[model samples]
Target chain A: MQRRFGDQEVDICIVGAGAAGGVLARDLARAGLKVVVLEAGPFWDPQQDFASDELSMQKLGWQETVLVAGNNPLKMGHNNTGRGVGGGTVHFTGVFLRFHESDFRVYSQDGVADDWPISYADLAPYYDRIEREIAVSGPKHFPWGPFAGPYPYPEREPLSANAVVFRQGCEKLGIKSAVTPLAILSAPFDGRPPCINRGFCNQGCLPNAKFSTLIQHIPQAIAAGAEVLPDCTVTQVEVDEKSRRVTGVIFVHDGTEYRQPAKIVILANFVVQMPRLLLNSATPAFPDGLANSSGMVGKGIMPHSSYDVYAKFPEEIRLYKGTPVLATTQDFYETDHTRGFVRGYTLHAHGARPVAMATGISVGAGTWGPQLRRAMLDFNFYARITQVGEVLPSEKNTVTLADEKDDNGLPLPLVTFGYGDNDLKLIDHAVAKMKEILTAAGGKPEFVIPDTAHLMGGCRMGADPRTSVVDQWGRTHDHPNLYLAGAPIFVTGGGVNPTETVMALAARTADHLIQQARRGL
Target chain B: MATKSHYPHYNVLDAAEDWDPHTRKIVEARLLPLESVEHLTTAETKTLYSVVAALIDDDRSEILDYVVKHFDDTLGKRIGESQRKTGVPPQADLIRRTLSGLGKTARDNYGKPFPELTVDEQHTILGQLERGQIPADGIWMNLPQKEAFTKLLSLTVEAYYSHPKIWSEIGHGGPAYPRGYVRTGPGLVDPWEAQREE
Candidate 1:
C-alpha cells in the first residue's frame, strides 16, 4: 500500500510542505517548472481529520525525540510547531500582520541585531499578493502596515467580547488599538467560505475557513503539476562533489529509502528541522554542513517571548465565543530606550479555550482545589491580553545535534535557550503595562502565562557572506542552487507573529528562482 | 436524582463529538476507558489510591480506583525515559522512592505507615515535602522533594478533572464538536453551554 518515488529528477525539490514550502511549490509549478514537495508528515483534509479536542491537538506537534537543554528549556513536541503537511499554519490562530519597515533595518535603527539584506519595500508586493491569495481580512484602512497597503477583504465584524474588553482597556490607557489582521476569511472568496467563528482555530479549523497552506497553496501546487509526496522525510540534500551544487535529496518513505535528484533544492522545514537536516547532510566536501561555511546554520535562534495578563469580571464575558485573537494594541510595538529595552511588544486580546485555561491554572496559577473550583465556575467571566514581545538573536541560544537518536536513528535536535537581559527587561515592561491597562478597565489581575511564540532566526539572511547563511534571495552563499524559505532566514524577529513575513519571504525566493531559470542559470 | 444545576439550559456534554475520530479518541483517553489495571503493582496502586484520596475530595471511591490505573500506566512508560537529567529522578522511581520515604517518615515520627496516619499527621509530612523542609538526612534527601510532590499533585489533579462528574461540578461545557459553537462572540452563549446564574 506504500507509494514509492525512485531516483527521479525534478526542476525543483522543496523539503517541507509548510507555509514556505507550500507557497514555493505553488509558484514554481505555476512558472512551468517541475516541483516536488517532500513533506515529513501526512497531508490531512481539514474536514476529515480536524476536531476540537485538546488531547488530539496536543499530539499534533513533532513527536519525534528532541532534547531540551540550557538555562531556559524549550518545550519541544508541544504546541510550539506542527508536523503536518500544512506545517504550523494548520494550527495557528491566523494572526497575519506584516513586519514593520524598521524590522528590516534593526541594526541601523536600534544598533542591536544585524540588518536584514532585504527591506520591507522589497517584500511588500509579495505580501500584497499573498494577502489577496489567502483572502486576509482586515480594517478598511489597516493602520499597522509599515508600507500601509489596503486590505483585499473586508474586516470581520462584531468583535468578540474578549477583543472589546481589550479595546476598552486600551482606550482607558489612551493607547492605540485596532482589529488584528487575520488570514481567516471574512467573506466567501475564491469558492472558500468565510469564518463561522467556531473559536477552535488552533484545532486546525475544521470548517476550512482559515487560510492554512493546506487549503491555500499545496492544492494549487498539485493542480499546477507539482508532485507533493507527504510522509516523506528528507534525510540528506546530496550535492555534486566537484561543483558544490545541490544535486538531489535522499529521503525515507515507509521505511524505504529513495534518492530524488533536483535541479534546485529548497529547505523550508521551519527553523529547528531545517538546520538539523542541513547539519545531518554534512559531506566530506563541506564537513561543517551544507551551506554552512559561515558557521551560522543553527545560531541566533529566537523564540518570541510572550506574557499574558488574565482578568476576572463580574459579568459573563464568554471569552471563547469567537476567533482566539481578533484584536490587539500595538502602541508599544516600536522601540523606546526609556523602557530599558531596545525593541518593544504588541498586546493582543487572547480568547483562550476553557480547557487551556484550566491547564494554565493547574500548572502555575497559584490556586488549587476549592480556590481553583471557584475560578473554573467563572470561566466565561475571564479575558486575557498577551504581550508578543521581540527577542534579540543570541549565538548562545542555539539548536545543536544531541547525542541521543530518534526512532529513525537521526540525532535529536538539542534546543539550548536562555532569555537575554534585554528580553527580560522587555517582558517586565510589557507585564507592567498590561497590568496597568487591565486595572484601568475595572478588571482584577488573575494570573500571568509566560511562554514563547513563533520560532525564528538560526540561518539568517544578509548581504555579507561571512556573517550570514543565505543571500537576500534565500540562496545559500556556499551553494548556487541550495535555498532556505522560512523564518530561519530572519535577521531580527519582530514583536509579532512572523508567519505572514515568512510567507512573503518564501514567495520572493520562489520568484527569484523562477527569474533565474528564465535567464537559464 | 440528577444533580441540580445553576446553568440549567446547557447540556454539559454537548461538545463531546462522537462522529469525529480525533475528538472521540481524546474523549476515550480523558475518560480513561480501561477494563482493568495493567501496569500498577498491588502496592503501588494502594499508595496512589491513598495519595489521591488525601489530595482530592473523598466522595468518589469509584472514580479514584479507575483513575489510578491511568496514572500507573503513564508513569510506567515515562520513568527513566527522560533524555535530559532534569534534577528529578525517573517518574517510576520517584513514585516508589517517595512513597517509601513517606512511610519511613510516618513510622519514625508517629509509629505508623503513611496510610494508617491520621489526616493531620499526613498533612504535616506532606507539607514538609512540599516546602522542601525535609531534613538533609531524610529518606527524600537525594530527590527534588518539592518537585516530586508537585509532579504527584499535578497528576492527581489531572486524573481528578478527566472525569465527567468533576467537569459538571466545575461548570465546564465538556466538548465542542459536531455542534461547534455558533455564538463565539462576546456575551453570547450557545444553547448547549452553561447559562449565567442571575
Candidate 2:
C-alpha cells in the first residue's frame, strides 16, 4: 500500500514536514510552486494530547530534543524526532525570541563570540513577518536583540506570579527587565481566542492559543493550495550529476519504496536528521552527501545554552497552577565586557504548573502517604527562576554519526558536549541573581540547584566554508537549494528561546528560494 | 501511594553514577497513571477536589500563562542526582537528560520513586495495606509529621487502592498533575471506623 509520489512532478521536493519544513512548504506552495512535502510523521490528533494525564509519564511524552545514543553510555537513549505532521511544533512550549542584534554579530562586537554568514538586519524583517503572520506578542517599543519594529502581535497575557517576583527581584537588583516577545496570544487577535489559562500548553494546546504550525501556517498553506501527505518519510534523495541539481526524492510509504522527481529538492528536516537525509543521498555525482562537498556536512551544530535554578518558599503559594513562563530580563543579553562569560544569558522566571511543581517537591520529600501529600500542599507556594544563556560555538562541541545503529540501521548521532569555564562561570553569576530573587521574594531558605541544561554550539552558520556549514540565509554551501533551520545553524547560541529566530530564518530562506527559482538557474 | 505529579522529575538515568543500585527494580516498573473515576471511594475522591480547589484559590491559571511564554526546558541538580544514583559520572549524556519527564508522573503511575527499593519493603507496605492494617501513627505522605512513616500502612496506600478515580486520572491523558489526589488522616476517618487489623 505504498503511495508513489503523485504522478505530476513537483517544482520542489521538501523532506521533513516538521516545524521548518512545514512552514517552508506552505510558503513555497502559496507562491504558485507545485511542492511535495514528505513528512516522517502522520497528522497529529489533538485528542491524543495526553502529556497532562497522571498516567502519561515522561517516557510516553513526545521528546523536544534529539536523544543522541551510543558513545555516551551514561546518557539516556533515543535520538528522537517530533513524530507526526506538525513535527516538534505540536509539543514545543511556544516561546518565540529573535536573537538580539549582538547575537547576530557576536564576533564583531566583543571579538569573543563567532560571526554569522548574514547580519541581523538581513533576517530582521523576516522575523517581523513571521511574528506578524504567527501573531507573536511582545512590547513593540522595546529594543530586542539587534532589531525592533512595530508590535507584530498584541501583548496580552498577564505576567505569571514568578514573573512578578522576577520583576521585583530585578527592581531590587536594578537590572533591566521586560516581558519577553512570544508566539503565545496574550489578549487575543487574528480571530483566534486568547489563552484560556490552561497550564498544559507543552503537553499540547487544543484551544489553539499557542501558535503551532498546524493552527497557523499549515492551515493557510492548505487553503492557498498545497497538498500534505502525512506519515510519509523520505528515505533518500536522487540528484542528476550532469545537471548538478536534485533530480527528485525517493521515499517509502507503508513499507513500499517510491520516487518523485522535481526540479528542486528542499531538505527542511531541521538540523539533526537533515544531514542524515543528505548523507544517505548517495549518487555518482555526490558520493559523500547530497550537499556535503565542502566536507562541512554535520559540522557546527549549536543547541541553546540551557539555564536552570530552583528555590523553596514558606507560604502555600500554589506556584504550579499558573502559566509556566511569561516575562524575561534581557540585561545580560549583549557584549557586557565586564562579565567573565563570553555570552550572557537571558533571565526568565514564571509560575510553575502545579503538576510539575508537586513533582519537584516530591523528589526530596518522602513519597507514599502524608509526607508526599504535605510536600505537594506545601510546595503549592514555592517558586523557582531560571535563565537561557547563549554559548559561543567551538569546533570541539559537535554531533557526528556514531558507530551504533538505530532500529532503522542508520548510524545514530553521537553528541559530545560539555560546558566551558565561560558557560559555567556565567551560570554561577545567573545563580547568584536567582538567589537574590528568591531571597527578596521572602523565600526564607533559598538555595541554588546545580548546573544543567545549557544547549549551544553545533552545525554553525557563517559565510566561510572553512568555519561554517550553512550561509547566513541557512542555505548549505554544498547544496544550493537545501536549507538548515532550528538551533543547529546558529553560529553562536543566543540567550533566549531560539524558536522565534528559527521562524525568522525559515521565512527568510523561503523568500530567497523563491528569488532563486524565478531566476531559473 | 501518591501519584506522579507528587514528584517533579522522572524517566531515564542522566549519568551512570546517579542511580542508587537498590532502587533500580522500583524505577523500571510502570504503574498505571490512573484509577477509573467511578471506582474512587467517597473520601479519597473528595481529596482530589480539595487539591484542585486550593489551586484555583491560589490563581494558578494566571501564573501558568506567564511561564508558558518563556518556556525553556532545563534540568539542574536533579540531573546530578540522576547520575549519582546510578554511580555513573556526568558526561555528554547530561545535556540530553531531561528532568522534566521525571516529574511526579512516574511516582504516581508506579507508586514508588526510588528504583532500588528492596522487595521486602515493597511487600511489607503492600501486604499491610491489603490486610487493612491501619497503624497507630498518622501519615507519611501528609505534612507536619513525627511518626509519619508509621502511618504508611493506613492512609496513603488505602487511598491509592480504594480511590479508582485518582488512579485513573494519574494513569491517563495529561502528565500526572500535582495535588490532584487528597491526603489521608483525621479529616478522613474516625478511629472506630478505621480498617485496622488488630
Candidate 3:
C-alpha cells in the first residue's frame, strides 16, 4: 500500500524521476514493493507543454543557478541538463548507444582511467533487454563496437540531406559509416507511432514517436502501483545516527516540508544534484558528507567533448528536414597512441535548426552584425558534423557547495571542469578528420565550434571502498540501505552517449535490490 | 537600410496553418504586441533597444521592441541558464548593471547617450566590451565585461532569430507538425518547404 506523507515507512523512496529512477520504480514496483518517486519538476503532458519554438521549448531544461568554475567553464542549459519528470531524456537526441567492451576495462586496455568493477558481460543482457524494450532502430550491420549487426528494428529510411552528405564523405574517404542506432521508433509499437521526420526531437517530441521515461517507464511504473510525486524538491536525506542508516528524505512541496519514511533510499538524480544532496546531508557521524568514506562524493566529474564542424556545400542541405543525428562513424572511437591522444571519438552528422545554427556561429566563431547575417543567409548550404570525444577523469574536476543557497535553503552546487591535455588533443584530431571528410565530399569546411555535452561521473563506482563512493551494484560504501544510481556512478565515461549505459546500470542495480529484498537483507 | 535576405521569395508563415494547434499557438504568440516592460527601467530599455539593433545590424522598430520586451519578460520571470561562471553575478544583475555601464561609457567617451551614438561608434564600443577592454570604474567596477556582453548578445540573437519574419528571411520551414517531411533525400525539398530563388 502507498504510504501517506507522514511518518509511515514504505519499502523504497527514490529521489528522482529520470531515466534510472523511472526504471527502478517500474522494476521494483512490479516486484510487489511499495515505491514513491519524488521529482523536483512538474509532470508534463507532452501534447500540452511541448512547442516547436526553440525559445519556448528551452523551459524543458533545468534553470536553477549552479556556479561553474575552471579554465573551460561549462555552459549549462538546454544542452546538458533537463527539468520535469523525464529529466534530460525529455529533450535529448534519441542516439542510444552501448559503451564498447574496452570501455569497461579502460585501465587494463589503455592504463588511463580506473576499470569498472563489472564488465560488459555482466551488463550485456540488460543492454539487450533495454534495446528490445525501447524498440531501437538501426542498420543491420554496425561497422564498429563489440556487438554488431541485426538490431531489433530495421534502420529508418529516406535519409536527410545532412546524413547523405556525411555518408558520401565517409565513402569517398574509404571509411565506414552507418545509420546511427536511435531510441526513436521506426515502426509502430505498443500504441506509439513511428517517427515522422518532424526535426523537432530536441524540443520535446509531440507525436510520441521518440522514447522518453516520461512517456514510457513512468506510466508503466504508475500502473504497477508506484506513486509518483512531482514538484517536490528533496532538501535532505535524513539519517539515523545510531543505526548509521538513512531513514528517508525531507522534501518541500507548495511551501510545506514533509518527511516520508522508507526502509531503503535511492539517490538516482543527475551528477550535480546527487553530489549536492549527499554533501548537504552531512551529519555528526559523517562530517564530510554521507557516503564520503573515501571523500569521493563530489570528485572526478566528466563531460564529453562535443564540438561541431560546419561545412558549406554548393547544393542546398536543409539540415532541419529530418532527425537531427542519423548517420555516425566510430572509426576513431578506440585509442590509438599514434594519434597523440589516449582515447578517440565518434563523429555524427548532426542537423541544426535556425536558432541553434545562428547562436552556435555567434558564440563559437564570434561573428556578429554583417558576418552573422551573411552566415544565416546561407543556412541551407551548411552541413554539420559533431564529435563525441572521451574525457579522462581528473580529481580536480568536481562539484562542491557554494556560499549561495537556493530557494529550498540548501547551498547551491558549484561545478568545476576543465579539459585535460589528452582531451584537447583528441578534439583537435577529430576536428581535422571531420574537415577531411567534408572536403572529400566536395564541400568547404567553414567553421569549427568548440562545445561539450553528456555530464557523467562524480559519485564514481569502483571495487575498493577507499577510492570510490559506490559499489558495482550502486550501493554506497558507508551506508547499507542507501544507493546511488544513474550517470553519477559512471567510473569512466565512454566515447558515446551515456543514456543506454545509465539505464543498463540502473536495471542491474534494481535486480540486486530485488534479490536482497527477497532475502530480507 | 533594410536587412537583405538570400531567399527573398520564401515565407515560413505560409505553412503555419498546417502545424498542430498547440505549437501554432505558441509560435504565433511571438507576433503579439508588447504588453508591458515588467523588469527594465525606461532608460535601461532604451539603451537595450539600441544595443540589440546595433548587434544584429537591423533597425526595424518592431523587431527591436519585441526583443527588448522578451528580455524583460525573461528577467521578470527569473528564468535563466542552469549555471553561471563563478564570480559572475546573476543574469538579471549583470544585465541591469551592464546597460547602465554602457550608457556611462557612451557619455564619458562619445559625449552622447548610447541611443544617440552613431552606428560605427556603437559597433566600436560593443567590440571593446566583447574584448573586455572597457574600463572598469563606476558601474563597471568588478564586472566581467566579456561575459556580460556575450550573455546580452546571446539573448538578443535568440529573440531576433525566433521571429517568424526572420525565419522567412533565412528560409527556415518554421514548425512542421502533423505534416512532416516526406521527401528528405539529399538536396530534396517537399512542396511546402522553403525554396530559394536563383
Candidate 4:
C-alpha cells in the first residue's frame, strides 16, 4: 500500500528517484513494504518534455552552483551529473558495460587504488540480471570482461561512419574491437520500440528506445504501491536521538517543509549531493556527520580522465548518424607496467553534434575567430575517438560544504579535484594510442580535447569501519538503517560507463534489505 | 561581411518539418524575436554583440543579434554552467565585469570603444585577454583573465553553432527525430543529409 506523510512510520524511504532508488523502490514495494521516494527535480514525461536540441536538453542536468577548486577544476553539470527523476541515465550515452574482474581487485592486480569489498563473482549474477532486465544489446561474445556470450538483445546494426572508421583502425593495428554493449534497445522489448539511429541519445531519447529508470523502474515502482514525490528536495536525514538509527527525512515540496517517517532511509543521490546531505545533516550526537565514524564522508573522489581525440578523415564521416557510441575497444584495459601507467583505459568511437564539436575545439584547442570557424565548417569530415582513462583515488579530492548557501538555504557543495601524476601519465598514454588508431584508419589526428566524466566515490564502501562509510551491502558503518545505494558507495571507479554497475549494486542492496525485512529486523 | 560557408548548397531547415513536435517547438523558439533586454544594459549588450562577432568571425546582423539575445536569455534565467572556479563570481557577474573591462582596455590602449576599434585591434586585445597578458586594473583586479576569455568564447561558440543557418554552413543534419537515418555505413548519406559540392 502506498503510504503518505503522516504520524505513522513507513517501511522504507528512498531519496532521489534515479537509477538506484528506482530499483530499490520497485523491489521493496513489490515485497509488500510501504515505500516512499523523494526526487529533487521534475518527473518528466519523455514525449512531452524531451527535445532534440542540445541547448534545451541541458535542462536534464543539475544546474545548481558548485564551487570548484584544485589544479584542474572539474566542470560540473550536463557532462558529469544529472537532475530530474531519471538522473544522468536520462541524458547518458547508454553505453552499458560490466567492470572486469580486475576492476574489483585494483589494489591486488595493479597495486593502486583500494580493493572493492566484494569481488566480481559477487556482482556477476546481478550484472547478468540487470542486462537482461534492460535488454542490453551487444556481440555474441564480448571481447572483454569475465561473462561472455550473447546479450539479451542482438547487437545494433549498420554501424555509423565513426564506428566503422574506428573499427578499421583497430583492425589495421591488430587490436580487438566490438560493438559496444548498450542499454539502448535494438529490438522491441516491453512495448518500447527499437532505436531508429536518432544520434541524440545524449539529449534525452525522444522515441522511448533508450532505457532509463524514469521510463522503466520508476513506473514499475509506482505500480507496486510506492509513493514517488517529484520536485521534492530532501534537506536533511533525521535520526533517533538515543538509538542513533535513521528516523526519516525532512524535505521541501512546493515551498513547504514536511517530514516522512520511515523505518529505513537510503541516500541514492550521486557523488556530490550524497556527501553534501550527510555533512549538512550533522547533529550534536554525531558531531562530524551522520555516518562519519571513519571521517570518510566526502574523500577519495575520482572521475575518469575522459579525453576526446578528433581526427579529420578524407571521407565524409558524418558522426551524428547513429548512436553517440556504437563501437569500443578494451585492448588497453589491463595494466602493463611497460606503458609507465599503473592502469589502462578504454577507447570509444564517439559521435559529436555541431555545438559539442565547436565547443570542444574552442575550449580544448583554444581555437577562436577565423580558425574556429574554419574547423567547424569541416565538421562533417571529422571522426572522433574518446578514452576513458582510469584515475587513481586521491584524498585531496573532496566535496566539502561551502560557506555560501544555495536557493534552499543550505550550504553549497565545494568540489575540489585534481589529477595526480599517475593520472596524467595514463591520459598521455591513452591519447597517443587514440591518435595512432585514428592515423592507421587513414585520418589525420588533429585536436585532443581534455575532459573528465563519471564522478564516483566520496562515500565508499569497505569492510573496515575505521576507513569506510558503508559496508559491502551499502549499510552505513555508524547507522544500521542508513544506507547508500549508488555511485557514492563505489570503492574504485572502473574505466567504463558506470550505470550498469550502479544498478547492479542497487539490486544487490535491495536483496540484502529484503532479507533483513524477512528476519523482522 | 557575412562569413562564407564551405558547403553553401546545404540547408538544414529544409528537413525541419520532420522533427518531433516538442523538438520543433524548442528549435523554433531560438528564432523568435527578443521582447526586451532582461540581463544586460544597452551598453553592455552592444559590447557583447561586438565581442561575439569578433569571437565567431561573423558580421551578419541577424546572426549576431540572435546570438546576443540567446546569451542574454541564458544570463537572465541563470541556466548557463553554474559551476565556477574558486573566487570567481557567478557567470552573469563575470560576463558583465569582463565586458566592462574590455571596453575600458580598448579606450585606454587604442583611444576608442571596443566596437569602434579595427578588427585587427580587437583580435589583439582578445588574444591578450586569453593569454592573461592584460594588466589587472580597475574592473580587471582579482579577475581570472584566461578563464573569463574561455567562458566568453565557449558561450559564443555554443550560440553561434546552435543557429540553423550555421548548421547549414557546417553541413550538419539538424534534429533527427521520428524519422531517423537509415544509411549509417561508411561514406553513406541519407537523401536529406548535406552533400559537399566537389
Runs off by more than 4 Å, candidate 1:
A1-5, A145-149, B1-10, B14-33, B49-167, B182-186
Per-residue lDDT tens digits for candidate 3, residues B64-109, read 7778977898687654468899888888899999999999999999
Candidate 4 per-residue C-alpha lDDT over B137-166 given as tens digits, one digit per residue, 9 for 90 to 100: 788999999989988998888888888888
Query: Among all windows of ten consecutive residues in candidate 1 chain B, which has the lowest summed lDDT?
Result: B78-87
What tens digits encode model 1's per-residue C-alpha lDDT throughout B154-196? 6666666656555555455555555555765556776767766
**Which run of 10 residues does model 1 chain A get worst, by summed lDDT?**
A362-371
Question: Model 4: how far is A247 from its true place, Å?
Answer: 0.5
Under CAPRI classification, how is model 1 graded? acceptable
lDDT of 2 at B173: 15
State the displacement of the C-alpha of residue A501, model 3, in Å, after optimal TM-score superposition.
Answer: 0.4
Question: Runs in model 2 with CA error above 4 Å?
Answer: A1-7, A47-51, A54-81, A147-150, A282-287, A354-377, A444-458, B1-198
- How do the predictions measure up, each by TM-score? 0.90, 0.70, 0.98, 0.98
TM-score of chain A of each: 0.97, 0.88, 0.98, 0.98
Backbone clashes in candidate 2 total: 107
- Which interface RMSD values do the candidates have, in the order shown? 5.1, 13.2, 2.5, 2.8
- Model 1 lDDT per residue over A125-238, tens place: 998888988888988766564745467888876788888878888898888788888999889988887887777888788778888889879999989988889988899999
Candidate 3 residues lying further than 4 Å off, grouped into runs, are A1-6, B1-3
Winner of 1 and 4 under DockQ: 4
Residue-level lDDT for B182 in candidate 4: 95
Sort by lDDT, top down from the best: 3, 4, 1, 2
Q: Give the residue spans of candidate 4 off by over 4 A.
A: A1-3, B1-4, B33-35, B78-80
